[model samples]
Every structure is written in structure tokens, then in C-alpha cells.
Target: MGTSEFMLAGLVPGIAQTLDVSLARAGYLTAAFAAGMVVGAPLMAALSRTWRRRTALRAFLVLFIAAHIAGGLTTSFAVLLATRVVAAVAYAGFLAVALTAAAGLVPPDRTGRALAVLLGGTTLACVAGIPGGALLDAAFGWRAAFWVVALLCLPAFAAVSRVADTPAGGVTDLRAELRELRHLAGALLLAALVNAATFGVFTYLAPVAAGVAPVPVVLAAFGFGCFAGITAAGRLADRWPGHVVAIGGSLLLTGWIVLALVPGALVFLVFTQGALSFAVGGTLITRILRQATGAPTMAGSYATAALNVGATAGPVLAGAMNPFRVAAALVAVALVSAVAGRSGRPAGPGRPSRSRRR
Candidate 1:
């Protein structure tokens, strides 16, 4: 799902050419996907409240597959954009339910690690899925790429269908859940900040690297680094979650500072990009999920929404600035994370009738 959301991103030129539009116009597809996720997360979570986690996941996977198939068949750019929005809905829904299901399968202490494993697929998509989509686009046509994703979803659907028919714990009291999450509002802000920091630089990374290394090569390096960083962070999250976030954020901030000072240094560009990706990947997500105990779907939905909000906002805001000045956005990200870390009031297990006095 993550792969599908991003698959068309680097292929904007090809899509625009195929759809008979300008490159800038094709960029709207990316924005549309983010917008869908932001809107879909809570929508799906609330709507699917009565379904089992596995059931919700399976439904989302099927919808995702259908969306891609529709995308492949569409000639109109508007239709394609609409299909991508459906794909984003499925993507966000699948993620929210899958996280909830994964947590249910694990012991309390192991939930973070389990989520890491689940999300590893997203990072892996960066490695294999998006690149594979790009290759398919090059060899075949843009539509062929969508067909390939539709075909890939078949096995995932089969796997999802086999899970037990257990009920999703309960329906969300969205208002109450929102209230509980507000207690940790600082953390959600930090999550948004972290995503904003990464996307601010990442959205423009191809241009930055085009001046140094070839675009494909730098992107490949970035993908592998993402996989490596996430795997490492996942391994450490169960026992050392705080340390992982702190060290990762520091590295991310330091990398941005270097990039700001040394505009187009190839080595810094590659390494710092990796550092930023590492910081934003698996570790922080796991920690954030762990902080919310009741209403796993709601927590997941809220977190997903926060991330999409930042992801969408970051690029638009950064694009308005001189691209080089984007580094200042990362600086703000680092400071926000630092302040969030300091100001955080811990959320404890179970929903409280009245807010717990700390």
C-alpha cells in the first residue's frame, strides 16, 4: 500500500506524458494520494468499527487491488487521480487495521517490535516495489505498472482471508479516544514534525541529487539506506525505543545542518538523506503506537492522519521557499521533536474515567 502511494511519485514525468498533461499537473496525483490518506484514515477506522481486524484488512487489500486495476484501465487523468485516491484509502485503511491486528497477536511488551516487523514491508516497498514499478513503466507502459500491483495483491488477499474471524476489540468512542490522545498531543505534534522534516528534504531530493549523482542511483541508495535504517531501528525499539528516537532525531538534525551549510556535496547529500530517512522510519512510529494503549485502531488512525497531514503540508510549504532553504524546515523539525520530548506527559495503560493525575 505504501508502495502504491509512492510508486507514481518518481514517475510523474512518464505519467504526465502518458496522460497528455504537463509534469507539474501530474504532481497533483501525489498530492491527491496524501490527501486521501489524511481523510481516509479516520473515515475508514470509524466506518469499519464493527468488522474484525482481519476482515477490515482483507477488504482494504481487495479495494486496493481494484483501485490499481481501475487505474490501469483509465485513459483520463481525472479518472486516474480518482483511482489513486481510492488506492490511498485502501492503503491507509489496511495500515490502520493491520497495526491493530498485529498488536492483538503479540504480548504487551512485544507489540512495538511486532509493529516494526509489520511496517518493514513499507520500507521494503521503497527498496523493491517503487523501483519495480518504475522499471515496469520503462519497459512496458505506465498502465502496466498498475496491472503489476493488482497482480501482486492477489497473494496478500489470500493471506488475509486465512486469518481467524475474531472480532475487532470494540467500536471506537471517537470523541473519547480523541480526548485520550490529546493528553499526548505533544507526541503527535512531534510525529508530524518528524514527518515534515523528512518530507521537506525528501520531496526535493531528486533535484538535489541530479546535480551530483544520477537520480536513479541516488534514489536506489536512499531506498537501501531506508531498509537498513528501519531494520536496525525496529530491532532496537522494544528495549531502547527512547534512545532510538533521540539518536535518530539528532542524526537527522545534524545531517540537515550539514546539508544547509554544504549545499550540493554528493557525499553529504547521500549520507544525510539516509540519516534523515533512518530517523523518520520505523523507530518513532513504534514508539508512538506504544504510547496509546486503548483503541488501537483509533490510535493508529490518529497517527496515520498526523503523518499524512505533515507529509502533505511539508512539501507544499517547502516548495514555496527557495529549495535550498528547505533545510530550515528540518531545523524546525528537530527543535519541535526536542521540545515534544521534554514536554511529553506519559499516557498510561487503559482508558481512564477521569484523566489520571500524574
Candidate 2:
């Protein structure tokens, strides 16, 4: 699903040029996609409670495949935009069901691992699908890239059909889910703030890279660093989940400031941006889940919603900032993360302080 969306990133400049639209209009492609994610997360969660998991998964994939094909066939930008929303709806529904299904399939001890695998698919999608789509767009028309995505889903759909079916859990109790929300204020607020900072800086990553070093070398360095950071986050989360976020956010804060101030260290700048991506995508997801501790279902939905919200907001905030301003914003975010980390410390062996265990 992420790859499918990233595919649009490569296509947007071309699409805008082809359609003779403003960049802002072309930008709506992202908004439309994200809008779907925002609306879809909760809607899918609500819907999943009604359908059997396997049945819902199959239906959502089918719809996603159909939407992709529809998007490829459309010539009217409005129609294409609408089709993208359809694809988003399908994507959101599939994710909600997929995560729920994964949890059901695994032992409680392994839920984190299961979620990590699901998220890893998205990271790998960036590594492979986005670049591949860009190359396809370069060779053929950008429309061909959408067609490629439409074609790829056929096998994905077939494979999804093969997963063994499980019995549905109790009817999704929305009231219970609603009750969980009140207790999650700290986690939710922290997530929103973290995403805003990460997205703000990350949204401007390419420009930040170009400003610091030779663009080509910077890109390669960034990709390599992202791979390393993402690989490390899962293991780190297992031991010091909270600390992992603090460390990751701190790296991002420091890195973005360097990129903004140094102005000619592409390698280091790229390394930092890559770290932000890797940490935000990896540890941040885990952090959101951990915060949702006792409320997996609602947490899953809300986390997904927070991700969409961040993805939506980051670029807009970044776009609004001047270079130095962007760096300052990142530093502010880092500080907030550090403070949140201090307050969120879980009680562990030999760590009780005054007023605890009273």
C-alpha cells in the first residue's frame, strides 16, 4: 500500500506537467490519498468487526486491485483523484484487517514481531517499489507506473486468499474502544507531536539533501543509512523501547539542524534524514503500539490514524518553514520527545522513586 502511494511521488511532477496543472493541484494527489487514510482507518476498524476476517481481507484486496486499475484507466484528473481515494479506502481497510488478523494468528508474546513484519513490508516497498516505479515512469509514461501497480496486485490478491481463516473475535465493542481513548491522551499527544516534527523535516528531505551535498551521492548515502537504522530499531525496541524513540528523535533533531546550518555536508545531512525516516517508521510505530499497551485494537486504529495525520501534516509544515526555521522546528520536536520520554518512563526493577509504591 505504501509502495503504491510512493509510486505517485515519482509520477506527480510528470502528472502535473502532463495535465498542465499547478504543483499545488498535483499535490492534491497526496492529500486525496491521505484523506482516504484518515477516513479509512476508523471506518475500516468499524467495518472489520462486522465481517469475518478472511472475508474482509479478500474483499478489501479485490477492491484495492479494482481501484488501481480504475485509476490507471482514467484520463480525467478528477476521476483519477477519485480512483486514488478508492484505492486509499481499500488500502486502509486491508491494513486494519491485516493487523487484526496477524495478532490473532500469533501468540501474545509475538504480537510486536507480527506488527514489525507488517510495517517492514512498507519499508521494503520504499526500497524496491518506489524506485522501480520511478524507473518505469522514466522509461514509459507516468501512467504506465499506475498500470504496473494495478498489475502487481493480482498475485497479492491470490496469495491473500490462501491464508487460513480464523474465527471472528467477539463483536467489536466500540464503547470499549472509546473508553480506551481517555487513558491514552499522553501517548496520542506525543505521537501527534513527534509525527508533526518528523514529517515537517522529512517532507523537505530531498531539498535538504541537495542543499548539503552532491545530490546523487546524498541520495545513495541516505538510502544506505535508512536501511541500517530500520534494521536496528526492531531489536532495540525489544530492550529499551522508550529509549529507542528518545535516541531516534534526538538523532533527527541534531541531524536536521546540521543540514539546515551546515549547508554543504550532504553525506551527514542525508545520514540524518535517513535516520529520521528509519527511526520514525520503525521505533515510532512501536512506541505508538506500546502506548496503546492494553488496547491493541483501538491503539492499532489510532496509531494508523496518527501516521496518516503525520504524513499529511509534515510536508505542509515543512513547506511553510525556511531552512533555518525547519531546523529550529526539528530541535523543538526533539526536546519535546526528550521530555515525553522522561515522563513516560515505565517502572522497572530498582527504579522506583519517591512517592511510588506508597
Candidate 3:
């Protein structure tokens, strides 16, 4: 969902130009998709309370296919935006339910490992899908990208069908789950801090790259770094689940700080960004899931909500300042990661008791 959400972002300007509209109006297409996700994620989680995890995943893929088709066929810009909205909602639903389900597939000892793999699906999509979509859009048209997405969904749907159902059981008590999360205030605060810090710099990655290198080369480097970084983080988590959060967070912080200060050294900046992305990308997501497994479904849903909140806020935060000023933001992200690491001691044996005092 995240990859698909982002894949079309690069095309928006061109799309707007083609439609003969303002860039801001063109940008609304992206917003419409996000709006759909905001509406769909929780609703899907709540509705799928009775279904097994695998079942929900397959259903979500089916929806993905349908939404892509809708997007491919649309004519007017408004219709395209509406299709994107529907696609985002469907993607949100898939994400919310899929993570909860994935957690049930592994042993408690390696829950972090399992969650890493689940989240990896999205990361991998970003790695391969976004660039691939861009190339396809360039080769065919922006509409062709949607057709490709629809085609991609066929295999995903089939693969999801083979995974055995492992239901978390009982209808979700979303209200009660929200109430439980209040006890983990420290973790939540840390999550917000991490988001603000990381995104502050990341939202303006393009500009930062432009300052250091040409746009095309910098973007390619950034994508590669993110892809490599996310995969590496997942490996680190599997190898030493306890230390990944700290190691990853620290590296991410350092990377951003470097990129912000030395905008002229493209090679160094790319390496830093990749390393930082690798560590932080894996650490933040995996850690959040680890903290929230007590109410896996609701926790996953809430985590997604927090992610959206961060992504939405990042641009607002970045937009308020000169792009060069973002270096400070990366440093702040590192601090948040460090603090979160301090509090993120792993739970042993059974799920951490929600009733136990934090």
C-alpha cells in the first residue's frame, strides 16, 4: 500500500500539466489517496475482526486489483482522484489487517523477526515498485502504471491465498485497546519524536539531494539507500533483535546529520542516507510492532495511524523552513531514536501484560 501510495507521487506534476491544472490541484490527487487510506485502515481492521489474518490479506489484494482497474479506466482528473482514494482505502485495509495476521505466523521469541518480514513487503515494494512504476509511466503513460499495479495484484492475491489462516480471535474491542495504549505513553511519545525527527529531513530529501548532487542521480541514490537500508535493518533485527533499535536509530541520526551539513559530497551523502534509511526504517517499524503486539490488530492499526500522522506532519514541518535547515531536523530525529532505544527493552516469554504498570 505504501509503495503504491508513493509510486504515483512522481507522476502528479506531469499529470497536472496534462490536465491543465495547478500543481496544488494536481497534488490533491495524492491527498485524495491518503484520505482514502485514513478512512479505510481502521474501518477494515474493525470489519475484519471476525476473519482470519490470511483471509483478510487475500480480500485486500482483490480490492487492490479492482482499484487499480478503476484508476486505469478513469478519464477526468476528478475520477482519477476518486479511484486513487478508493485504492488508498483498500491499501490501508490490507496493511492494517496484514500486519496483525503476520504476527500470528511466528513464534513469540521471534515476533520482531516476523514483523520485520511483514513490514518488509511494503519496503520491498518501495525498493522495486516505485522506480519500476516510474519507468513504466515514462514508457507508456501514467495510466499504464495503474494497469501494471492491477496486474501485480493478481500474483499477490494468489500468494496470499496459500498462506494458512491464523485468526487472533474474538471481535476487536477498539475502544478498550485505545485505553490500554494510554499506559504506554513513553513509547508513544518516542514514536512521535522519531517521526518528527526522521521525516523532518526525509520530507525534503529531494531538495537536500539537489543541493548536493543532480536530481536524477540523487533520487536514484536515495532510493537505493532506502532499499538497502530497510533490508539490512531487517537482517539486523533477526540476528540480534534486542540491539537493532539502538543501532539502527543511531546510524539513521548520524546519516541525516551528515546529509544536512555536507550537501556538496554526493557520494558520502548517498552512503549516509542509505545506512540511515536502513537502520531507521527497519528499527522504527519493527519496534512499534513489538511494543503493540499486546493488541496486535489494534496495535498494528494504531501504528499505521501514527505513521500516517508522521508522514502528513513531515511535509508541514519541512515546508516551514529553508530546505537547508533540515539538517537540524535529522539531528532531532536521532535524539528521539536514542531516547526510544533507552526505553525499548525487549519483553520476555509471553506477551507483555497490558495490566502490568509501565
Ranking by lDDT: 1, 2, 3
Cα TM-score per model: 0.88, 0.84, 0.84
lDDT, candidate 1, 1-358, per-residue tens: 7777778865787899988999988988988899999999878987887788888988899899999988898889999999989999889888877776776787867876677677767766765656777788889877887888898889988888887767875665757766767655666677776767566666677887787777777776766666667666666777776666666666666666666777666454564466456545566667567777655557777778877887887787778874445645654665666556565544547533224421
Instruction: Report how far off residue 209 is in candidate 3 (Å).
Output: 2.1
The number of clashing residue pairs in model 1 is 0
Residue range 1-358, candidate 2, lDDT tens digits: 7778767766888888887888889879888998998789768767676667778888888888788777777777898889889889888878876766775676654555666667666655655555677788789978888777777888877887887776545354777776777756555555565666545654555677665566546555555566666666656755666566666666666666665667665564666566565655566566556555445455566767766776777677778765435645744664675576557767678557524522
Which one wins by lDDT: 1 or 3?
1
Name model 2 segments beyond 4 Å from true: 17-20, 128-130, 167-170, 290-296, 323-331, 334-358
lDDT of the structure predicted as candidate 2: 0.68
What would you estimate as the lDDT of candidate 3?
Answer: 0.65
lDDT of 3 at 61: 82
- What are the Cα lDDT values of the candidates? 0.73, 0.68, 0.65
Residue lDDT tens for model 3, 99-194: 666666776556556666676565556455556767877888777888877887788788888888777564657676667576455455445555
- What root-mean-square deviation over C-alphas does model 2 reach? 3.8
